[model samples]
Target: MRRLLFWLLLFALPSTQAAEELRLTNGEWAPYLGAQLPHHGIASRIVAEAFALEGIEVRWEFHPWARSLLLAERGDRHGSAVWLSSPHRKETFFVSDPILDSTYYLFHRKDRPLHWESIEDLAGLRLGATTGYDYGEPFQRAEAQQSLQIRRLGSDLLGFRQLLAGRLDAFPMDKVVGFDLLHEQFSSAERARLSFHPRPLRSDSLHLLLSRRIPQNADYMLRFNAGLARLRESGKVSQYLLEAQRPLSLGR
Candidate 1:
């Protein structure tokens, strides 16, 4: 009878508790999640709206990209949005359904065209990358072999400046971020003089990477996915993307 009662009680127990809030880690990247603005950027707004649908409050912690990633890896934080998914990271975390599609493109002087069929084509060229920015699989693997010259810049703005000044031969950055920096840091004349490689290095979906250590990750992911589904059905996601890209459309 005791064993029967125990089984009944176990079955009666709640499957999962409701998450009171979500804690996200982010860095200084803009047009995604800004360190200074809590509600800015497409990812930030999407996450905020998704959690709100579940009655979960959203909070953010802005740190250096490496430190923010470490916190997520250690399960000290819930997740980080706008992160690329990889097989290695999949072992430690659950990635949400893709929040957005992203492309890594090569930035170069407009006067000089860089023709490259693949990432390997850039071998022996000086390339600038922001510190802690993952270059996806091929570039990451190629970089490991020391086949490409990589200059790690402290910030995207600085890297664009370096590229413009001819200090670096090429730079790989997200298309949106590269465009944002070009407009924010360079004059119209200067911006007009810059261009991206004809082809993207890689195109993939970006996701909200939830740490496996969080006990409520499954619940969070479910709720987030549900909300995203509703958003997509209602065309809310498309509207948000349009708004996010508004600034880019001007004069482009």
Candidate 2:
């Protein structure tokens, strides 16, 4: 009777548990996702607020882009933010709804003008690309076929440095990120010397990626998507982005 009473009392007790904490990987992509920016930039801000709406707390760890993906895929972290989705990533991770949009542009020196209607036009020209970055399937195919001369650098900063040094003819980078980095890292004269082609290379959305190695992340992605939708409906996502883009002293 006592044992039966104990079981009844246990079942009657509240089943509610503490909200789970999620560890998410991030990288330094300013005005979007960065460790130094206020609230770790707009994308990270949106991620936190969205998860907060669902009663999940997030802890962020910043690393290089490649390492960030590795950690997430291994489930060392719950997920990573702001990655362009690809087939391999889709197979390995549960991709969330688009958190931000990215537009790619071919950046080059103003004095060294370049015009191209297609990938073939870029043959024999020196181009800089970042390691572990996929511009697109078309660009990839061209590089693989040896139709385009490309140099892979470790980061966008290095690519820009190569362009500035006249060692690279062109570098493809996100329009927003290119401008943001120029403003933050270069002098006024340096910024003036560089420009991006008016024609965009491509446009893609950035998404949060949760590892498939963790079974709970499948459910997390659903909750994240739902919360993201709410944030979008509330118009806070746009609001956050506009606020982040505002110019400030020190460019933090």
Candidate 3:
């Protein structure tokens, strides 16, 4: 009876299953990624929910943009979240399906009134670029060939400040990120001083980069893409993005 009761009690107890966790390196790029933002911002939220559908949890390690890439490349972490796809990156990592879209514009001070219909138009002007960022193929080629005068900076905020100070003629930045920074960091008067060219520098998709060093990541990539498709089909992705924009609008 005692042995039977022991087996019965074991069967009666609830089962505890440990969830699978994936660690990804991250950086602060607000409205998309920030350690303090709700769900760590929209992109992070989407990535997490997609993985959740596949019964995996995400653990994000916050670092500088360059360091984040380094950690992922070295396999110190599982991968990096929210990076633009590039040929170099493709060689080092397995790029996932598009997680978000980003449009780049050349931001300049309103007083300067910069005009550029093509990459060659602004050749002589001082341009500010963030370190470890991809501004697109045309811009990259121009910079490499010394056709454009480019200055590499540490962050987007610093690049914008350079533009306002007249040190930089223009800075390439994401349209949404540029405005968000202006709204968050500058006064109304300061905000009024900044503007972006109507023409976009480039439009690119953001993707999750899983490390090539991890053999299992190949499988993870397949699972992530499947889960993402389901999330999109359910219309939750658009709903969540629309909801995120509401707070930004209210703050502005």
Q: Which numbered prediction scores highest in lDDT against the true structure?
A: 2
Per-residue C-alpha lDDT of model 3 across residues 1-252, encoded as one tens digit per residue: 999999999999988878989999888988889999899988999999999999999999899888999999998899998988988999999999999899998888878898888999998999999997888989999999999999999888899888889999999988777777777887777777777788999998999999999989999989999999999999999987676552223124
Question: Cα miss at 189, model 1 (Å)?
Answer: 1.2
Counted clashes in each candidate structure: 0, 0, 0
Question: Please, what is the whole-model Cα lDDT of each candidate in the order they appear?
Answer: 0.80, 0.89, 0.88
lDDT (tens digit, per residue) of candidate 2 on 1-252: 999999999999998887789999999988898998989988999999999999899999999888998999999999999898989899999999999888888999989999998888889899999988888878989989988999999889999888999999999998777878878788778877877777777889999999999999999999999999999999999898777552422122
Q: Give each model a TM-score.
A: 0.84, 0.87, 0.89
Expressed as tens digits, the lDDT of each residue in 83-196 for candidate 1 is 888898899889889888888888888767788897778987889987777777888888888888988888888888888888888888787877777777778877877778
Which candidate achieves the best TM-score against the true structure?
A: 3
lDDT comparing candidate 3 with the true structure: 0.88
Better of 1 and 3 by lDDT: 3
Looking at candidate 1, the ten consecutive residues that score lowest on lDDT are 243-252
Error of 2 at 14 (Å): 14
